[model samples]
Target: MVASGDVGVAFAMVCGAGAASSLGASCVFAVKVASPRVLAIALGFAAGVMIYVVFAEILSQNAIDSFQDAGYSGNAAYRLATACFFGGMLATAALEALAPAEVVAVLQSDPHTRDLLRMSIVTGLAIALHNVPEGLATFVGALEDSEVGASIAVAIAIHNIPEGICVAMPIYYATGSKWKAFFWGSLTGLAEPLGGLLGYLVLSKEEPLSFGIVFSLVAGMMVFVSFKELLPSAFRFDAIDRVVSTSVIVGMAVMAASLLLFTL
Candidate 1:
């Protein structure tokens, strides 16, 4: 499973496997209906994974590396990391504003047999930008601390699950083919590990700088995904205002707690 070129395939398999697991689990027992409470919990879990990656992996690592600097305190490095993380979040927010409205329009206008071919291309570009640094994070973690790396990898995999579902749901709803929808959804996520591999091959020649750049980009990518995809999707779930607010708050709180506990 950890072999080379398996990065994207691994992500797809992991996410698809989760979907498969759910189906299999349903067979053994009664299907666990995802009520508003359950949806909120799943969102919270995703948030926890995100927050852990941003602080624990990004900030803590930066603080340690900066220890050797003459005037720089670990505290300063930590602060800097926080600033960058938030800054990355802001950058993502900005990009979300630029998300092609045409895509959304098309998705809603005619879900079945909708002309999403162009929108899919745009999605691929956006995902590619997001995947590059994620891949590096996975690779670097695996190399430096296999145990920690494995944890991060698994967390990332968990994070990608909803993402896979998000991609597939629309297409599936439109086209009515679970397999095709799943295929595209899973394929889009492969960019991360693929980017990871490419980043490693290119950046490994220069260690610290490579790590820093990779970390920074990962931060950027997360912010983009959060604002551009996750938050929007959360709101799109039309049920009740209370449900939406509760879900969003839970997501934020979950991320905050995960950062404080795992990273701080």
Candidate 2:
């Protein structure tokens, strides 16, 4: 039941939602200090928010819903979704293992900036990849019904605001440049508009299970990045477990609250 007209308006709607990441990234300027403790909390917060969304939103809700929309039913849909989840994890593991050490070192030559830069880049990439499906969904929703699409787009923009924080804060702490942080954070969101274009023209109509698969894959990639990159970087930057742990909880609370807004 996808209509083909209004491409311009739908594109704009998705772009507006995507830009919220930049809006969130801009918030880093308000923080007063650039310190190891701040970076730790940011990293922990990023991990917590991502981990919560992976379980509570992506895998639990979006993936299943997409599959059911594709005519999958009951436990069969759950089983397929779980399999795709593990497949995503294994794929990320393979890619991480295959990445050359020399390339990694070359990317960030400064010892101080090395791990933090790499981790943030990985986090941004994962988030960006996930946004593709989201963009598609937004475009399709808009094409189906403008009012509902606008409502969903606003909700998505609010949720993305925190994800922007997740991408920018660590980079700001690492490089001490608000511009650099915002640039990278904004880059991650560009995927949304691009995804909207691709989905509207290519995927949304013909491919029903694509969103479900992409959701599971990205959720896996996010969980992997949280444990492998975010948490470890947090511990390395600051030894205070109490602060990191508390920030992690706060991040989860923020993400949960944002997601709950979707239901209302």
Candidate 3:
């Protein structure tokens, strides 16, 4: 059973994830400007980081952990992991389908203020949904290993920067209120802590959680967010192909190196 202290640590780490989003939002106010091309490249980079982590670390680790901890044969462990991964993807797909649509009509609205307000709210809600699994991942990692959790948090924080910009820029432009932008942007990340709390409560029973299943599910969620949300949104910015590609490559390389460094 996870000790009370460990639970506290896990919650703290999850809170840090929320703070990362706030930090990212703060950057928008600091710069007082937003560039679609820059945001696009950042989003591409975030996608690459998440994709690499999901495939290289999370999925592989899930299989290995299952084989070792659950006494499943290698094939069986892999199969189970794959199933859990797909299950997570299906869940995220459902969430995406149900994401708020009322604000979408604002895209075509003639009034710039109305358009920006609606767009900001929509972006915040979307990011909030994406952050749920991420929060769970961070909390779970921390519960298992503090170092691993910290690394994951750093990677997730990097990705959240662009998300913060997405929320902040439009709102600031629309309302010309830094406080409003910051509040909304920070609000988007609050879901992380809530997710973390829920995960802890569900997984902290006397029966230990299944690492394989949970990890695989988390990997799937990250993959869905990377491809379905981050990459597509990045491309929508009309960023130059080379910039996006280069950013993605650089992001993968950096995450790979970080993981390697942490292991050593």
User: How many steric clashes does model 2 contain?
Assistant: 0
For residues 118-223, what per-residue lDDT tens digits would candidate 3 score against the true structure? 6678878877886888788778777766766765666566667666766776777788888888888788878889878877776666332366677777778878
User: For candidate 2, what is the lDDT?
Assistant: 0.69
Candidate 1 lDDT tens digits, 1-264: 135544444344333323432231122122332343444445444444554555555546642463323244667655655565566566555654555554333435445454665565465345445544455555555544444455445545544554454455555555656676657666666566565566557554555544554455556555455445544544454344446455545555654564456545
Once superposed on the true structure, which residue ranges of model 3 sit more than 4 Å away at CA?
Answer: 1-6, 27-31, 100-119, 206-209, 262-264
Off by over 4 Å in 1: 1-39, 63-109, 113-121, 173-178, 223-264
Query: Which residue pairs collide in model 2, if any?
Result: none
lDDT per residue (tens digit) for residues 7-81 in model 2: 667888899989988877887777543455766777788667767767886678777787888899968778878
The most accurate candidate by TM-score is 3
For each candidate, what is the lDDT? 0.50, 0.69, 0.73
Model 2 lDDT, residue 236, Cα: 64
TM-score of each: 0.59, 0.57, 0.82
- Name the lDDT value of residue 50 in candidate 1: 50
